[model samples]
Target chain A: MHLVGLQAENFRNFSTVQLSFAKHTNLITGSNGSGKSNLIELIYYALFSRSFKTSEDMNLLHWKESYLRTQIEFQRDGVDKTVVVSFNSNKEKKVLLNNIPEKFSVLFRESSVIVFSPSTSQLVKGLPSVRRKWLDRILVRVDREFTSILYSYQQTLRNRNALIKRKLIQKEDYDLYDLLTTNLVSLSSLIRKGRQDLIKMINAVISPTVSKMDLPMFSSIELKYYHSRMMEDPSLLAKEEIKRGGTLIGAHLDQIEIFHGDASVRDFSSEGEQKLISFCLKLCEFDLIQVKTKNSPVCLIDDLFSELDEDRAQLLFKYVSSVSQTIFTDLTGRLIEADKVIPLTREENTICLP
Target chain B: MYEFTPSYLKAVEELHQLPGIGPKSAEKLAASFLKMKQEDFHGFVEALQELREKVKQCSRCYNLAESELCLICSDPERDQTKLCVVEESKDLVAIEKTGAYNGLYHVLQGVLKPIEGIQSNKIRLKELFHRLQHESFQEIILATNFNYEGELTAMYIVKELKNSSLTISRLASGLPMGSDIEFADQLTLKNAFRGREKFSEEMI
Candidate 1:
């Protein structure tokens, strides 16, 4: 997949900007605070209809502006499609695919993107919740049934928690509890299996990439699934869950631990090593998405030059340029060899540097 | 605000109280009523008045009825050993229109919604349990909506009748008859896949 064009209005520091992209590699060079990251963010938002940086949509709006709008035109499977995302100060957001309104789930099924930003290191260093979310995002995109299964599991968990909170399970309520737990067990098993399968596929792609990178600290990186024991014996957990007055176990408590040799990368790896692992994981993500969807995803690398050392950056650029369409930002304005180069300047607002 | 007469404003206000009829729609309905012939207008009002005065809940199944028992419960040709439970009388009518079900019905009047302060006791579940105890049903079908509250209510009924020897089932949820699979929502498609039936060579 490749992005053909992007248009934005009142989005972050870019008041109004329209630009086309190359099918292979596009280098966005700009000074500090020149809205380079914002451009990449707009591309991400157009695909997902949500910002990766912040949960609040208002933060994407330009200062003194009440609304932000962005449109992205991309080609997938030899067909052109447009995605438009608009948000106002009232927190109302609208997403349109090919001028027709759509839910985020449907949009995600059609488009896929792998982002490597400054915060990408969080996958290795952040809490277990982050890794679980990452795994779920990828799994949901790859399998459509997984979305509904996950949704049902979440709803069942909420209802079960509510029932437990009542603390008065009537004779009749026992059956309800059993029904809910049965659903939770089955759904969690499906989710656990989906994540496990995704991790396996990702590991298959990532192991060689990590090894090929010749990073000594992470010569043998592995992605492992850590699930709650309740998945195997839900009945046992049910007894403890009633005493705890909440659900004691499920995929919600699961994690994806990244291991480097004998220890967790989060505990032992250096910052640069963590970043490299994250980069490898994203490359695996790009490959997995392509293999699953049969369409390569647009890769967005923000501040790539600053994020990696010269050798690592060159390796990443070489890999992405050969396999997928990539757009990366550089602040030094150094001429990076690419199919297209977009130089941005920051005055009161961002503009294309002549 | 004072452009219309008092009776016209009152008519509009009453029309607006109907579900899904906003203030603008209420005005439009009232204007259409005004444009109707005098006899037709009186007939419409009389029909509504008759509905309120004559329509009563079926004593046996709590469905809408004009007599002691609902039409389905009283029909001699309908299956007496099968009972289909629904959340509302409108659902009974919808099923009846499909011409697919010839079994009796028991309207719960509403689903069990604890969050909305609607407990099992608040609805007609007591009557349902009483009927279940007295009636010798071979099978009971839970035809509730495919939603969280409906599922909860159905589960509660199943639990209540756990000791009974009757076969119990739920309405199969799937894509509508004319909908394309590509257009069906994920939940609907998933349910359809879950409830799919195996085909046999003899049936073919």
Candidate 2:
């Protein structure tokens, strides 16, 4: 899939803007705080109807503006599709696909996007839940049933937690507790299986992708799946859960430990090694989405060049250029090659395609 | 804005109090009532008045009825041994329309939502426990909706009746009949997988 055009109104710092994109590569260059990130955010918002930068929709609205609106035209499977998203201070947000109101799930099913920004490195160094979320997001896109299983698992966890918090377990409550634990185990097993499969796929490419980048410090990389204790003696785990007054063993506690030989990457890797690993992980994500959906996702790289060295940046750009379409932001356009360059300024928000 | 008569405005406000009936829908309904014949409008008003005055909670099941017992509970053919518990009378009606269940029903009227200050004692749970203690049931089917609050309510009831000998089961959730696998959503598909039945050869 490739993005053809984008239009934004009263969104963030831009009052109104329109720009067409190239099928291969589009470069967005600007100084600090010139709405470069906001442009990528508009594209993300148009596809997902939510901003990646902030959870609050009102923050996307320009100051003194009542609402924010964005429209994106893209081509998928040789067919043109349009998506429009708008939100107001009243907190009413609407997403329309082809002029018809659509659910967020439908919007997600219709479009596949893989984003890499400065903060995405948290996937490598963040908490277990962060990795779980990243894995679940990709899994949901790869296997449609993964979303439902994840949702069911979450609902089961919430119910079980509420029951545990009540602090009064009657003789009769034992049956319900047993039933809830059974469900929790089953759901967690399913989610863990999905994550394990995804990690296997990611591991398959992480080494080669990193090796292709030719970073000398990194000889090999591996993603180790940390199975939850629930996969062990579930009855023992249940007893532990009851004693702890909360769930102790489930997918929520699982992790994907990245390792370089014997040392943990998150602990021993240098800053450059971490950045390269993060970029390789994103490339694996792009490849996985392509393999699962049979269509390359539109890549959005936000200020990635700033963190990488010249060689790494060139490697990243070369990989991104091989994809169907890539939209990236940089502080300067000197090192980046693009089919089109969009220069954003604070005063004039006008955008030209080429 | 065109001014409506005081009586029309009052009717619109009252209609707006109904669930999901916004002010615009209330005004439209009021206008439609005015356009009807006098006798028809009087009949509509009389029906509304009777709805509140005559409708009473069934003593046996707590479903809305005009007498001591609901139609389902009073029916002698229904299997008293198999009781289906539901959250509302609307759910009972939906299940009855399916012609798939021949068991009697007990309406809890609502579910347990502790965050909203609703507990087991807040609904008709006491009555349910009393009925279960006094009545002899072979199987109790929890037919609550497959949602957070509904599942919580069903699980709570199951806990309340854990010591009892009656077999308890929840309503099976899966893809609807005639739904194509390709078009079914992920949740439905997952449910279908969860509820899949083992196949055995009978005559094949």
Identify the candidate with maximal DockQ. 1
Each model's fraction of native contacts: 0.20, 0.20
lDDT per residue as tens, model 1, B1-204:
449999999999999999999999999999999899999999999999999998998999999899988787889998989999999999999999999888899999998764444566679888988888898789999999878789878988887888999899999988887889998877788889999989978766
lDDT tens digits by residue: candidate 1, A125-193: 999999998989988888888887888788788877876776535644555677777778888999989
Q: Each candidate's DockQ score against the native complex?
A: 0.33, 0.30
Count backbone overlaps in model 2.
Answer: 0
Clashing pairs in 2: none
Model 2 per-residue lDDT tens digits across residues B11-40 = 999999999999999999988987999999
Shift in Å, residue A168, candidate 2: 3.3
Q: Is the docking of candidate 2 incorrect, acceptable, medium or high quality?
A: acceptable
Worst 10 residues of 1 chain A by lDDT: A167-176
Q: What does the lDDT come to for candidate 2?
A: 0.83
DockQ of 2: 0.30
lDDT of 2 by residue, A1-354 (tens): 999999888888888878899889999989998888988888999889988889999888888999988899999999999999989999998989999998777787888898888877887887877778888999888777787778778877776776666643554345455666777788888988899888888888776676767764554677888876644675676566667888776789888888998899899987867777887888888888998899999999898678678888788778867966989999888887798999988776555453
Q: How close is every model to the real structure, measured as TM-score?
A: 0.86, 0.86
